[model samples]
Target chain A: MALTGLFLCTFLLVHLIGNLQLFKADGGMAFNVYAVFMTTNPLIKFTSYGLYAIIIFHAFWGLYLVSENKKARPVAYAMVDGKANSQWTSRWMGVLGTIILAFIVMHMAGFWAKYKFGEVPYVQYERNIVDGSMTYGPSAPIESKKEQFVSAETGMEYTIVKDLYTEVAVAFKEWWIVLLYVLAMAAVSFHLVHGFSSAFQTLGVHHSKYNGLIKFVGIWVFGIIVPILFAAMPVYFFIQ
Target chain B: MKITLKVWRQKNTNTSGQFETYKLDHVSEDMSFLEMFDVLNEQLINEGKEPVVFDHDCREGICGMCSMYINGRPHGPKHGVTTCQLHMRSFKDGDIIVVEPWRAAAFPVLKDLSVDRSSFDRIMSAGGFVSVNAGNAQDANNLPIGKEIADEAFMSAACIGCGACVAACKNASAMLFVSAKVSQLALLPQGQPEAKRRAIAMVNQMDAEGFGACTNTGACSAECPKEISLSNIARLNREYLSASFTAQVD
Candidate 1:
């Protein structure tokens, strides 16, 4: 559970940085190209399979731990003052993890599955490679799709890629979609606040010398920064 | 002062339990919680009724014989004190206090508030001791251990085996207690020879005793009467990992 959880946490950081390309003002050129690279890259594609397996294993393993823990205490306390001794997040990890798993399914179906199989609007950018100027072209189907080509008549470079960036914008435009995305990020934030440092403790990395650093990164970076930034993408799209 | 008590009453392990309420008058604020219980039991005797049963000893706190889930928290709402050390003054004059035994599959209730903690005894016997050939008494200064290491070991040694850790845990995990025992010896020089085997043996026995796996919730430490630090648990994990990696298959 600790190893897989930390792996997923690292994946979240890389994913967050990659998705930051959306905020660029270049008409989704940066984000679109980045998406194509992420999907089509041979190395990343293979690693993603392992990432998927780890996620599934972590989720179900967490549930199994919950059941075993439940059996340890066959009877419940008549009234428990759990808040006095511990953080609410630490105790409810199983519940928060379940929510995060559900969110993963919803999120993947909304964007990842859509980009891979659904009808994605295409954008063709015609650029003067020398002068750094650009233009847009009509959306007629090209029988042979090339990532970049030289237009004979215009004597300029043209690049065509699936416009997944626009698909993200369209999906986030709905209030409910934006709300769900924000809520899921909240769950992620809470889950990670307890999870990140806990992984270290379980893996035997805990000590006074490094505990402060672990806690700072756990709460501020993964728990607050990463989730908030991921959440901002949807809100930015909705408001804009 | 007057107070209402809702205490758990059970005949034995085979029978289910129920909450029974009793109203008492003329309670003094200065009386300890157990003294108040004593008064209630005296009242029950006068009325020819079976008095409520609970576990307690050494009334000071060192014995760790007392186990009570008072007002939903083990050892009551007071921090860093056993049930014996808990004063009645912590509650209001009209408070209704509820008390129950430590509930865990490994620690079965013997009666109303007393449980069989022989499982902990079994775990302790599994690896909680050091074996050496009998010889003449060695000088106390022979060890030459550092002060910091000694203090850390002493802190872990303070664990009174009070099963409050088990009672306080949401999962009823005995990791805090098991880890304390492991740290008490693993930090010292004399304990080095058997550290690997001890870690593996104790944890295996702990699992065999039906204790839940630890999830690193700080509840056990927070509720500990001795305030045993959670750092011991981290050290135990380190020791267990190192042991497992270096352990012999033979």
Candidate 2:
């Protein structure tokens, strides 16, 4: 569970980096190009399969651990001040994880699945000319060649490209969607607060000298900083 | 002082338990928690009723036989003290004190507040002792253990085999108890020979005993009568991982 959780943590950072491209002021050209690159890159595509497997395994393993824990105490105490014994997040990791799992399902369905299979509307950026040959559009120049161009795949003169950036922007423009993203990111933060250093301890990397430092980073950096940055993305787009 | 007691009462291992409340007046402030229970038991005995049954060996806090969860804490609200050592001064007049047995599947209540703690003994017996042969006491200087290492080991060794760590755990995990024993042995030169075997054996026993995995909550240490550090749990993790990797050669 620890190894898989850490793997997911790394993936979060990479995903955050990719998503940050949406904030660029290039009329969605750069962001869409990056999104296409992420989807098409063979290496990333293969790793994405592994990522999916890890996420599912992490969730199930967590479920198994929690079920076994529940069995450890068959009789419930009449009065329990659980806060006296442990942190709220430590006790409710399963609940937070389930929330994140639900969020992941909705998130992928809303964005990833739509980008892949849903009918995403398209925009036509002006094609550029460099060195006497037609090249991809540039951010600064907004001119398209007047000559009619035919596409083999659709068999039509392509007037537009897939406008995934606008899809994201439109989604964020709704206050409810942004609210959901913020709430889900809050769950992610709580999950990481326990999971970050917990994975190291589970994998037996707890050094006498470095253990405290690891926990510090787990609670402070991963728990606080990463979640804030992630939540900020939607808020940034909503205002924009 | 006047106080209200909500103590768990169970007939036997086969019967379900419930709380029975008893109000007491003129309670002394200096009376230990156990003494207050004794007063209650005296009242029950005077009324020709079966008194509450609980476990206690060395009331001064050394022998970890005492098991009770008072007011949502393993050993009442006091830190670094057993239930027997806790004084009534910690409570106020007209206080409501709720006490129960250690709640764990592995620790079924035999009767009243007494639960079976043989699960701890089983885990301990799996590998808690060194294999040194019987002989006259060796010279104290022979070990040559550094002061820091000796202090660390002694701290871990202070674990009195109490079930408070287990009771205090949300998952009913025995990690603190098991880890304290492991950490004590893992730190000493006498315990080095069988270190790998001991780690694996004890941890496997802990798992088989239906204890939950440690999620590093630090509650055990907080409520520990001995105040055993959570670092011991970390050391146990390290030791177990090391043993699993090198067990083939051993």
lDDT of 1 by residue, B146-211 (tens): 999999999999999999899989999999999999999999987888999999999999999898
Error of 2 at B134 (Å): 6.2
Query: Candidate 2's residue-wise lDDT over A27-121, tens digit each?
Result: 77667777777887899999999999999999989999899899998999988867876788877889999999999999999999998888776
Return the clash pairs for model 1, or none: none
Compose the digit string of candidate 1's lDDT tens values, residues A1-240.
Answer: 899999999999999999999998777878888888888889999999999999999999999999999999997779788999999889999999999999999989988998888877788888887787888654555443327789768778888888887888898899999999899999999999999999998887877899999999999999999999999999999999
In order of appearance, the predictions have TM-scores of 0.97, 0.92
Per-residue lDDT of B202-240 in model 2, one digit per residue for the tens? 999999988887877778888999999887887898899
**Which candidate number maximizes TM-score?**
1
Query: What TM-score would chain A of each candidate receive against the reference chain A?
Result: 0.95, 0.84
Return the lDDT, model 2, position A64. Answer: 93
Question: CA lDDT, every prediction?
Answer: 0.90, 0.86
- In DockQ, how does model 2 score against the reference complex? 0.59
DockQ category of candidate 1 = high
